[model samples]
Target: MSLEQDVATARQALEALDRACASVTKHVGETVDARRLRGDLSRVRDDLDLMAGQQSYSAYEPFAGVYGDGDDEGFGGAGRTGR
Candidate 1:
């Protein structure tokens, strides 16, 4: 199949996986493992969304300032610079 077809198939599979995850969550309360799994699934779905253009790349975008020059320090800036 073509690349577009493969992406479509993967999207559908992700949708089905989402439904299954929901069903499992409903049947069994959101245990620790279940919550962790859900979090992981959410991240995967977000990635798929980014691939499908359903979501923007803003979250993954690079910071607009330097790291130690009193800038935003990107994402992992602890207590070194600006917020």
Candidate 2:
């Protein structure tokens, strides 16, 4: 399977897990275990989001001008990127 297909499958699984968690929380009254499960689910969602985003976005990619060729956007070029 392709990456996009894998990501879609994972997202669908996460959605199902989210609904299950909701049902469990409602039945269990949000106990410590329930909260921990929610936290773990949230972390998994975040990780999946990050991974999928990197496939189409550059948020996790390194700068093309790592050595500061006036393209660092003032990050390390001392504000000399000229906007």
Candidate 3:
């Protein structure tokens, strides 16, 4: 129900999926489909890592600054201007 709990559940699910993929690859010998599945799994894992990291920040971290203050860039806030 909480963010931490949800993240933990997702991570467990991803780990299980990773193990299953490994087993399939071991038996199937890296076929195209197997490779695709592995790639997708890797991307999903990366996404999960990112989400977990973001969620670990304190609640105020996201809103502590407005207008792209040096302390917080706001994670893709429109206040950012490309050099």
Candidate 4:
């Protein structure tokens, strides 16, 4: 897919994640696993924060490389080269 498409998809995913997190939050006092849900919500929020950053959205790939650790060297290369 194109970079624009990737951005749209990521935006949609972020929105969905936000909605799910909100729903979970609404159940804070009613659910037994509220703590677990809160943790999940936090994790999702962290991911959303990452997605909103330039580095995370720089390419279209799903997994990011560890720059300092040299683990993601070849995983990225101009996300949209042709168009």
Residue 61, candidate 3: C-alpha displacement in angstroms: 24
Worst 10 residues of 4 by lDDT: 57-66
Better TM-score candidate (3, 4) = 3
Scored against the true structure, residue 38 in model 2 reaches a CA lDDT of 86
Model 3, CA-based lDDT: 0.74
Off by over 4 Å in 2: 55-83
| Colliding pairs, model 3 | none
Candidate 4 per-residue lDDT, tens place, 33-62, comes to: 766766665565566556555443323454
For all predicted structures, in order, the TM-scores are 0.55, 0.58, 0.55, 0.35
Q: Any runs in candidate 4 off by more than 4 Å, and if so which?
A: 29-83
Error of 3 at 40 (Å): 0.6
Tens-digit lDDT track for model 3 on 4-34?
A: 7888899899899899889878988969999
- Report the Cα lDDT for candidate 1: 0.73
- Residues 1-83 of candidate 1 have per-residue lDDT tens digits of 87667778987898899888888888889799789988777777677677766754535645444333555545766566544
> Ten-residue segment with the worst summed lDDT in candidate 3?
55-64
* Cα lDDT for residue 65, candidate 2: 52
Q: Rate the local accuracy (lDDT) of all candidates.
A: 0.73, 0.76, 0.74, 0.61
Scored against the true structure, residue 68 in model 1 reaches a CA lDDT of: 35
True-structure RMSD, every candidate: 6.6, 8.2, 9.4, 14.0
lDDT of candidate model 4 versus the reference: 0.61
